[model samples]
Target: MTTRHSHAGTPNPLHSLIEPRALLEIAALPAGLPLLASAERGDGHPVLLLPGFLGDEGSLLALKYFLRNRGYDVQTWGLGRNLGFQTRHANALQQKIRFMHFKSGRKVSLVGWSLGGMFALYGAKAAPECVRNIITLGSPVSMGPEGSQSPPLVKAIYRLIAHPLGTHGHLAQPKARDLREQKRMPIPMSCLYSLSDGVVPPQEATIDGDPALHENIRVPGSHLGLAFNAVVLNIVADRLAQPEGDWHPYEPTGLTGRLYRLLTHKSLPL
Candidate 1:
């Protein structure tokens, strides 16, 4: 007898078990191993970095440094931690994005990890004029068929902290226009996901519709480790290097070409 397949949005408990690998990736960072090539460089545009749930700017230090070294003016999301929901949270985030756009005198790029990715998508939708593009790493954006890919522990913690803070359930919900714009995405967007991600399934981390404006890049790393993954960094650099209004999808090449082809699962546009 054949087993039935689960729906696209079904959660994967097995992937959740491997979350510990992220810790290993973090531990390896101190080894001083080279993670980026010298050839990579940005177009000097302002890029904002947002951390994952319960994460602060410190979690993205390596990524910021990598981008800075490549000539991109990178800024960190000043919000203390990613607590999912909270009153006026959406307004505050938009204010920050506007501030950056005004100060830079150009459309800014948003690079977010995990829940931060959701914010990035929201920001793009709320103010596409100020946003040039978006790049998400292991973020389970709700615009997809899947909602939150957070495991049981994370969900529990979110409920415990968010309820008291008044930023719980409903506050996190996107506005109707925010949802609609994200589905169409006026700005270019790139989603990077790893099958080995322990925090969320790969399917939940990628965009479901609109092939031309959205690109899903499959890389090798854990959900938590995506911020530090070499391949991820490379893709980030390449994407940021593109000139404004000249966006294009990413295609893995070079010595690792075969590996990328072998590892990626249905990343091309439909």
Candidate 2:
């Protein structure tokens, strides 16, 4: 007899149990500093960083420092702790993007982690003109096959602190489906996910859009530690370094590149 597993539309509980590994990933950050230091520097462009649910500017300090040190002017989502995306936050972000674009006299790049990715996507869609490029780290962006595949525990917590867990999150429910399924943003986007992520599955974190416009790059680490992952920072550096109107696909290099080539996912365009 053959035993099979079922598709439960949720992340495995075991991954949740090991979420503590995020700490290990954070502790190991210094080990990758040498390689990270070699990444291409920025061009003094403005980049906004958004943290995940219940996270605040504090959660993105490491990323801000890394990007700022590389010559980019990095700023954090200043709306205090992200208590799950809501209407008020969305409006505020739209204003923020406009100001950043106007003040800098250049398009602003958005770099978001986890739920923060949701905010970034929303912002880009709202004001693509003000935005340059987008990079998401381990965010739960539902693709074609998945429809808000949030774990039960996450769902419960979200409903309590944020909006109701209806079809598509209340943050961008009506447009959320359209955001992924149709009306793709014109902005260049890169999604970095970890196979080891526990909070959100890798599939849910990537985009299923035009191959030229969207990329699903895989990194190694935990969901909680993605913001601190060196491989992630390197990819962000490489992606951000691309000159406007001269963008191309990310060519993985170094040990991480070797590991990326080994992946059978074949993230090429459809």
Candidate 3:
């Protein structure tokens, strides 16, 4: 049996090459709006949407617009392109989280895609007070040897551009200390990954922790499509829409709920 934390060998290299398939899901977004309309709406909470590494706010426009239309105060990571985690990125992200929480007069719900999702998890631990909920799309739980399952080429490219990605951040402490805290989420945390994800492996994206505060949901889409995929957005909306201080495992019930379950045929992780 496959445990939630199992690596199950390296992820398939083919998925990394076929990441372009995400474009199809993006193209299908418009047609899925009607279905999204049936999702639960929150109490006009604030949401901070973060893009994957190297991507900017523009990459997340579709999902941001979708959430905004649903009555959410959706905003982007203000620090331009996600240029790997550096001192500036860490400091700015911390300030952004605090500002969003204070400005909206509500705790900010974080919605991150790919590398952005990893950043969200990091931010949540550093500033748990400001973050109300955490939702990640195809984000690995750890970038180090512990959880990374990216293809060798992907890792090589990332290392070439941005060395020491996770080690240096706002909450950069003893590596072991940080890892320990990361395992214990102080707020509701949900992870969504696709079985056929082209970049992030399903195991790496899933979390192993307390059932009360953590859940790993399997969506159906390419890694690049996580931000625009209808099902992914729907799950984020429903998770963020939960009443403040109230969090629960996600089950298919929104407008696209049945379609998601039918397509993925996954029982979900809690």
Q: What's the true lDDT of residue 149 in model 1?
A: 47
Candidate number with greatest TM-score: 3
Model 2 lDDT per residue over 1-270, tens place: 111112345666787778888899889999979868888898999999999998999999889999998999899979999987677897899899999999999999999999888889888888889999999988876544546666777778888888776434573456455556542577788888766677777667776666676777777677888888787888899999999877887887676566445542543311
Q: What CA RMSD would candidate 2 show?
A: 4.8
lDDT of each: 0.71, 0.78, 0.76
Shift in Å, residue 166, candidate 1: 12
* Candidate 1, run of 10 with poorest lDDT: 1-10
For candidate 3, which ten residues in a row score worst on lDDT? 167-176
Residue pairs that clash (backbone atoms under 3 angstroms), model 2: none
Worst 10 residues of 2 by lDDT: 1-10
TM-scores of the candidates in the order shown: 0.84, 0.88, 0.89
Tens digit per residue, CA lDDT, model 3, 1-270: 112545565566677788888888888998888778887776788899988977899999988888888899989988888766555676678789999888888899898888787678767777889999988888766544454567776666676666745323322445334644575577888888777786777777877767777888878778888888887888888898888877777778644666877878855443
TM-score of 2: 0.88
